[model samples]
Target chain A: MDDKLPGTLPGSRRPGRGPRQAQEIYRATLELLGGGGYDALTVEAVAARSGVNKTTIYRWWPDKDALLGAAIVQSSLLRFDVPDTGTLRGDLSGLVHRLVGLMTGEATSGVVVAALAAVAGRPSLAWLAREFVTDRLAGERAVFDRAVERGELSGSVDPALVLDLLAGAVWSRVMLRQAPVPDDFADEVVKVVLEGCAVRA
Target chain B: MDDKLPGTLPGSRRPGRGPRQAQEIYRATLELLGGGGYDALTVEAVAARSGVNKTTIYRWWPDKDALLGAAIVQSSLLRFDVPDTGTLRGDLSGLVHRLVGLMTGEATSGVVVAALAAVAGRPSLAWLAREFVTDRLAGERAVFDRAVERGELSGSVDPALVLDLLAGAVWSRVMLRQAPVPDDFADEVVKVVLEGCAVRA
Candidate 1:
């Protein structure tokens, strides 16, 4: 997820600060989102709960959707970094596993889906969603780029498409609830996607 | 996609009926949706605009969501049936092309995304979205099954996974808008997926 918080205060938190105020604001946002899906969440509630002024929130986020987007990125997706296990399979599988872990969690899933709904038609929020996904994919793209460098993958391979295929499959399972994401599903997908499933024994 | 409307009244239109009233209802629903999105659409408004009694709409559809869901399915997804080409390549590409057509259209894309947002947190609407996807995949699954029977695919291949890969790729392009669904993107995806990207020439 994109780490650049909109209108972030750089180096503003002095050494005497007891705790980063942004952390408190994020916690309040997540709590409100969990308690009342997306509709009931408001900047006023966030301010009341976080003890931060509403103007500060607006100055940083510009809107509720932006605040929620930043909070979600900070809370959930920021945890995973790109994996480099020396093989495409290892790296891909690791990425999928990390995603599976997040999707399977109740709190994260609630926040994620609610956030998507909150941003559905609004152009700015939609752009934020696209940016978040793109930023998260950057890590996986690194793995693919490395594979290309090592000649494990063709230099012409579209890292974006590769990431889309892998991520989309998981999204279908988790968001659409068509099927469960089994422990081995990622490995199977990586194998088929990498090696082609058409030529079977 | 799913031809089965949840509570469709078949042959309910009598001989004296000049034009089907359901069409009017659906048109009004779409108009309201296009103007104000899912939040502004109401059965009462549909009734007022279409001149259909609110009681009648309620009789046919249990609630506003059911009405909107039915209207969306009727207006959009119902029109596209699955393609049956002689080969998996043809079938997959055809399916992707059909989806690209819908996603690229302004009206359909608006309705589709609005419907998803309307159903995001609600269990019943979520179920409807899941059902819609599952029903759509059934057609693609048929193509895969036929390929296996024709010895074009391995008998051990997972039909669900194949559908997931294809549909997921399209969903990524359309829903995530990460990349454009180039005219040849489907063909490229089919080739890579079928032949395996791992072993490049």
Candidate 2:
């Protein structure tokens, strides 16, 4: 099951411990982050929660930020398969809908909220936020690339700007405004953006 | 300067204290929010910093969240004039550029970051974030209203979504990715969005 998961951090598994143990550590870290937030998260608390030895955990990750960063990267909450729906509109619509679910889902939203809180509050963890966004953007770039290849979008259309506008609207609604996302909102956004980016004859 | 500022919370001025005293308290609150974040902020700290009695603050606010909410509403950092450039493109371009500056500005970014941290981490303060966004959106609605009046945009266009996308793109770059905002980025976004919302001839 773990092997099927996308983008497991390389070398996360140590000499003696199996991938199962690493998963346990990551799980504990996320729970703590969701429950108490970044300031209250500590290596010792993770060790206690995971039942992993403190010394062993410390040997693997240098500090709380490193540990939290690893957990965030490896966590299922952050992972999503890039959509391939044969058109930019279809792909973006599907992606944005899923993003709304991921960000607002009860099972995952706490961790999302906690991670964002850490990103905003902790300067040391800013790199982690950047890496997470960059990695996600890179993965989503495939959709735009395919659209350009299909002539649905201009080659000159900036994928980063397109994706940012798409995702930022969702983030603003979910994270900043904490408002209910109206049905059809995602489709409306995708339509406008695609129209905005359509290659003029 | 105080009188010139927009949206000072009503009834904030007490019998003995002037608007000057209220400004001092708000200033001190923002400073503490910037310096130590929401978790470390306290009524005691504000009183000490602003030279206002904790009793007076408590009499007005009733709690930390209330005090913080008032401070955020009254802070000059959150205030901006609604641009009226006669066209949707010009107005949105100016608004997005100002947003990028406001979110990334050295004098204001810390308070912005701290307020976001509070919003994300503290559920009780979520209302504060919602209120702030709603108020800002209400203020900017005039831009879209003018565009519709001039037939520069469709009457059917959703102002909330447009504003969210524009501001969200900036926030995603400044607050999430912490990436540098390119010189032409704002205008590009505005152009795309306006095209997307253009009135169908």
Candidate 3:
């Protein structure tokens, strides 16, 4: 299917000539944003780097913000596919591992973190946040909900909230720049939270 | 005592000397950050606004990064004090509310967000991040550890991991700018994770 196409990989490949052009512009876009922040991700520079005209990029993405957003999508910045390991602990651990890996990876994490950071204040990224996270959360939720249906979770627990809490911690860690994202963090998180660890009266 | 001082209530305070000057500089630091992100925030501007000298700020702090770090010290900028609520639900909710209030507040939130965005490549902010979060986490860890000691949490539960997972979700939500930090999020997080939605084996 067209869905399982190139350019969607972690390294970013191009599809149509237009898609390829977009990818090239996006490459320059990432370099600029990565080298600096949102401010330096200029259309002029991106065009120059891609060897394409500014008019061309503008026609595709409209503005610096749009170009950045498009570049993010085309660049394969976020991979939300939930890892399946069957057990709740395994599932959640897999989820956490995937996230921590994505966040801590050297090549892409910078731009990814920056995307969620200062420039995210721009109105343009707001919709992108919703679209990206919603879909991402939905994917994870399906995994959790399946666990619930299998009676791994209390039937009453909210899947979305569960994912929210899990993702929230990593986001906080990264946002605060507090400490390294531990590899076993996801495993321990699933173990403690899923199994229970509070004083019951 | 120098610690027992007036003009400490933020906006209404008058700038006098010593800590007051620091406060004024911090206040200006926040304002400049709001108007612009990390790049636009200059020590010179902070000095000018606070009616203090750049050398003075440098005397207290090594550089602008340190100055900015000082500005974000354990004051209202970041609330690390978490209470010992007996129940996990109450404890987490209390902590989450405190954090949400701090990170989502009008004045400090912007700086918090911007600082996070800029921290990625700076590397200088690493010390700031550790000093800021470690103490806060220590407080919460004590609370959770108490619960564990009292048989509130299972003996096997790792307090650090729980805290990380809990904080992660809240961080992601805030950084992603996806939704308002709901008051009940922490409570729900505690319940779903601790109680387990799956049918008990």
Candidate 4:
């Protein structure tokens, strides 16, 4: 998520004023995002809620969008590290189950979806997409690229599209809220796409 | 995609209007969409561009958004059909490859991505995702469900999410313009995803 708020004041690197105040502001920001949708997330409210001056908040984030995005990225709620158990299937299966756990559990997939839908409206949010997408792709892409380098699969395949296509489907379902990313669905996604079951006639 | 446009006079079906007129209006709608993206795809301009009467255009589509949708779905451009080839790999591989083709060729991927981005601002278009999503899923779900019943795989898997995760990844890439869907990517998408490779481990 890109920071939706644009006009941010850069923060203080001074020793005494940093940790406690920044933590409070970030907490309030997350609380606001949780309680209200992304549109309702306000720097003014974060300042008030955290008892931090508005200047302090602005100093940390460039804009409301950026603040919100930073809050989300920093969030322990949806944070994850992709697992690597040697094979793509094993790794992705665990990842998918974890994903379902997040989407269905405390992370509040529906709210994130709505927030993202809301973000999708703003052109400025492209920055947010880039930030999160680049960061998130790191773990998934790492495993696939490693496998290719090991000659585990064909060198001709572009892992980028492979990752995007599978992940895209999951994101669409979550954001569109059309269906749940079911328990076994992710495994099926990894399986059919990788094995090339189609015996070319 | 559903014909958000009914192609009838406001109150009733006009028996008099023929396919040529319908084709012309649809053509105008696409041209307008091509020229100015979704925001400028207006009924009056479509009428003016195609030389069809404005009333005729409105008679079919209730609004520009509906007509814009109609233009996208009705265009013979990027048309695709499911090929059974009596195998899951063939079907899935073909689908992935075709989706990649459709997205990469449109160069309009950015337009569609931006359009999806833009739709976030309009509540009217947000609901329209289901309309477009359902049409795309209908054909694939039938094939998937049949495969399950045939003992090709476990019946417990949710066919919907399978499609969602698969389709979502492809679209996320296209909409984000992060990468192009390459030809060989389809093989990985088809293979690893279908055989329940992850679960087998």
Candidate 5:
């Protein structure tokens, strides 16, 4: 019953406060980030564009960094929930499918690219990015933990490396735009990493 | 004897021009890119800082984009000469090693990251990045091609995807700074992509 209550939610807004206002703030934040990136983004601008009081934003987020972090979480940039299929292959395929969607999404991609540039300029933002990436990777790492327990994977396999290869492939393709992420991309990538690309004895 | 001429050199400076001046200009360009991102970079400033005439710069490169492209080439950003080791594994290891070095180098990484940010605002820079990446990938593809002929790789393997994974792993590690690129980082990455992480049947 406690889990059913919105107040008990980990990342949810205050129970009494309306979700609509927060939604507006999040949308405005994404728009500003997309248009100006992080350096140029301001709390006042978000307030003016979002029609929410600056005080309201401050109440939720103590500082601009906090605000940006919350906005990123609220935005669809990190919206994918990790899946837990029985097999390692199924689990990885699900993770890649969700990753491709987030990366290739037009609106989210702009904010992400902008965020990446911002990190180069501001060292503080690196902390935010690391935190976000760590959180996302942790969720994906669980699948490997399951595989190791089931003896599908060797005890020596590093989950972080697996995540890096899977996520990195999609990221490079998305950023380069050399080719579109095909329908079979997730499956092909998973198979290569799992089954090996090279023929061995 | 026909290929022995200085004029036919791969990375040679222009004939009759001193390498010192070219080095100064490239140095100035890199400094500007590091201090301020692409939008903030200008030919006049580079000319003033480099002590090279603005007219000279214009004569050589019609636009700033051209100047940047040349500077990137001259900056040792892509200095890795592709290796032609007999084994596909050896070739890929060499390629990744060079890639890791270029990306982790302080001066080059600064420019590369700034250029990535600049791409978000300026579409033309994206074209330059694509061209650079395509050239790099083509060289790596040759290594794969050699392996195919040697019966080391199946003809069905996709060279592009292989390059993507190899590059993506190093890139993610570099940008995130989760861990240093170890001495054997390249070999490990190539091995994983070549040999499955999961136990075989």
Candidate 6:
């Protein structure tokens, strides 16, 4: 999804920075976002906080939304690294566990709630929310793809529905209900969804 | 949820009114909410718009949150009349169809989006959002209870998870993605979830 950002300046144009610089910039972005929200976030503020040149930030990210999008993609909030646990159930369980941690984590969850609040408050940033969810969905699709290849799931199963069910249950429990998720939540969701899809397949 | 409102006045203590008057009040509340959001909603405006006495409105609902909560429950946006289709699949499908309509309908969807925006913007009113979801979940639980009684589903199945998945997927599609749900979405979700739970049971 970061690849879809508007400006992808050439590597040569970058000021010969290391990954440490990029991490600093993203951290500053999230910190500013968490503190004052989207309206408070600006390329100039991020540059000042991270000591990165504003011109360099603009050279890579075209606008504030692009910068925030990139920062969110780099954040723990949107990381959807597919797990290859050899079985569909195991892979899903691993993914759900990571999601639970992200939602429950102190620093990460605050950033997430802030971002969502920003999007909810501003209609213009609705695209960012959509893009964020779409990107994560795309990343999570790999698990189902691998499951299909391994013959654990038939191609007939709807990956979107499966992923939505899994993540939705967690969102409902964590965000909506504002209740403690049981220790076995990830395993239970994975078990039911995998069994449901397997039977349908 | 409306019953859980802070103050519920007795029938004998109020002014005489018919269902039409209550409907007018709810309609006015929704209109104000849909127009200017939560900040614009007030007991005074609702009374003016509905032509009901402010004292009477206050007698029934103590404050703005209570009024808004009651209006929401009375609106089609939160109705969760469980279907008795004789089978869990049929009942769930019916419920999902109604949910999809509420999310997709031109008028109802706007009210839903407005109410959600209000809740998201104001942290204090988060209880309203939580109560709204909890109420709907409680109402929808009847389907599972009936299915259990008929032996179609084991009591082991998680009703909360099931409802979350169904509503969550629709929300993801209609609100998050701003995408049109496929015609068969309800049926597809019901089929997979029921088959999945059946296998687990």
TM-score of each: 0.82, 0.88, 0.81, 0.63, 0.84, 0.80
Sort by DockQ, top down from the best = 5, 1, 3, 2, 6, 4
Better of 2 and 3 by TM-score: 2
Worst 10 residues of 3 chain B by lDDT: B5-14
- Top-down TM-score ranking: 2, 5, 1, 3, 6, 4
The residue pairs that clash in candidate 6, if any, are A196-B196
Which number leads on DockQ? 5
**Tens digits of per-residue lDDT for model 6, B69-187:** 76775565457577888878888889889888886788777677777666654556666667777667777788888878887777888888777677767766666566668889888
DockQ of each: 0.51, 0.47, 0.49, 0.25, 0.54, 0.36
Across A1-201, the per-residue lDDT of candidate 5 in tens digits comes to 343312122233444444457777877887888787776688899999999999888777666776676666555445777788899999999998987877667767777777666765665566666666666766677898899998889989878788778877887777753358889999998988998899786
Model 3, B25-115: lDDT tens digits are 8788877776687778898999888899888776666667766766665345554567776766677777777766656788667776666
- Judged by whole-model lDDT over C-alpha atoms, candidate 4 comes out at 0.60
Q: What overall lDDT, based on C-alpha atoms, would model 6 receive against the true structure?
A: 0.71
Per-model lDDT: 0.70, 0.79, 0.66, 0.60, 0.73, 0.71
lDDT of 4 by residue, B1-201 (tens): 443343322233334433467677767766555556566777888888889888877776668876666555554553478767676667777777677666566544434444554354344565455555665666677667666666565666556656665666666665553445555666665555664222221
Worst 10 residues of 2 chain A by lDDT: A1-10
* Candidate 6 CAPRI grade: acceptable
Cα lDDT of model 3 by residue, A1-201, tens digit: 354432222222334445456567778888788777776778999988889988767655657766665566546555556777777778887887777777778877777766766344554566666656665665677776777777776666766666766676665565455576666667666665675556545
lDDT against true structure, model 3: 0.66
lDDT of 1 at A111: 66
Task: Pick the TM-score winner.
Answer: 2
Model 6 segments more than 4 A misplaced: A1-22, A39-62, A120-123, A197-201, B1-22, B40-48, B51-62, B120-123, B197-201
lDDT at position A84, candidate 2: 92
Better of 3 and 5 by lDDT: 5
Off by over 4 Å in 5: A1-23, A74-77, B1-24, B73-77
